[model samples]
Target: MITEFQLLDAPAVPTVVVKRAEVAATHLPELFDATFARFHAAIAEGVVAPSGPPFGLYLRMEDTLDIEIGFPGVLQSPDENLVASELPAGRIASAQYWGSFDGLPLAWAEFVSHVAGQGLSVAGPCWESYVTMPEPNMDPTTIRTDLFCAVS
Candidate 1:
């Protein structure tokens, strides 16, 4: 669960982008693995310098989700396979979670409520950044994910 929330003006970061137009919720695990694999391969191939932690950008989520998975990076140049992109930019309602990712939905619920409590409207896409990435089979209690709800 979120312990606190904040409003911040965010700046976009360059990324090694992988996006899906449509994805079922059940398919998210595989998508993250494949997308991150591509990110690592690009790193191994020296295509981009890992500039920051990984992120999951959510454009829309209803019957299906519009998503982009990527790592903020300093690209050597634009590669066709890995498009160079940027994360959402502007004002945002932010929340920090320091537990298993399974608690994310609830965290988001609190984040929106907190934003509304402050008289703000969510106006754009949202995203979650992996501030400290968890290793394979790592204890979820140690994870750190920073969520952002873009707002007007």
Candidate 2:
């Protein structure tokens, strides 16, 4: 996997999410699909226009996975089930992964190594922005996900 490292002045993005802890790898697909469906429904109902692609904000990744899955938005949702949160603004090391989600760990490993090699340390939770939505006949290689981990 090819990775790129850059400094970003990211802005805080509001989002509606479903927070989950210790999520099993097998359950992620279903979890994300259901969560995003609810999010899109809210978007359609005029809650907010999606500011960006869907993302999974990783709060914890060791021992157990903790994450919030949802869409970035301009307005907070009135639906109480969808928790409103923000993606913090800061410097980040990022990479674009062009394949299935299963290959993500490799991409992340390379990204983290690059960050450390540059004498930078992770400063916060990492997130994956799904830049391209999956389609029924879409090729896995064509899928795009941009991964980011805050660094300082």
Candidate 3:
């Protein structure tokens, strides 16, 4: 399920601690877990999130997905494990998604189709902002993910 799509001016994110990965679709869960684990470790080392929520930047989606996952904030100490980066400024077409993670592929496909139907060109990396992350004992239907695709 998804909410009505909206196009908004998305400002450039100045600070972020991201870990890039190239992995097959089947490994996403483990990839997210490890990436978030790196963020937690960075927090212990003085990284702060003064910007926005956690996000996954979908750079490329082919046979293997190229993704960068992390929180929006400064990575004071750059290391080999994690790098500092920013989300580009642009117009973003977005919608709120409801349900479990398993349905995201279809959701994204639908959303992308809708964006294309609007005649908006995808200008940059698409992303998903995690509004309500999955938790133990929580209903799968309660999950809320906000999808954003940078559009021209």
Per-residue lDDT over 65-136 for candidate 1, one digit per residue giving the tens place of the 0 to 100 score: 998888888777667767777877899888888887777888788888888888998998888998977789
Candidate 2 TM-score, true structure as reference: 0.90
Q: How does residue 48 of candidate 2 score in lDDT?
A: 62
Question: Candidate 2 at 83: error in angstroms?
Answer: 1.9
Give the TM-scores of the predictions, in the order they appear: 0.91, 0.90, 0.89
Better of 1 and 3 by TM-score: 1
User: Model 3, residue 57: what's the lDDT?
Assistant: 88
The whole-model lDDT of each prediction reads: 0.84, 0.84, 0.82
- Top candidate (TM-score): 1
15 Cα displacement, candidate 1 (Å) = 1.8
lDDT of 3 at 22: 66
Please say which candidate is ahead in TM-score: 1 or 2: 1
Off by over 4 Å in 2: none
- Order the numbered candidates by lDDT, best leading: 1, 2, 3
Residue pairs that clash (backbone atoms under 3 angstroms), model 3:
none
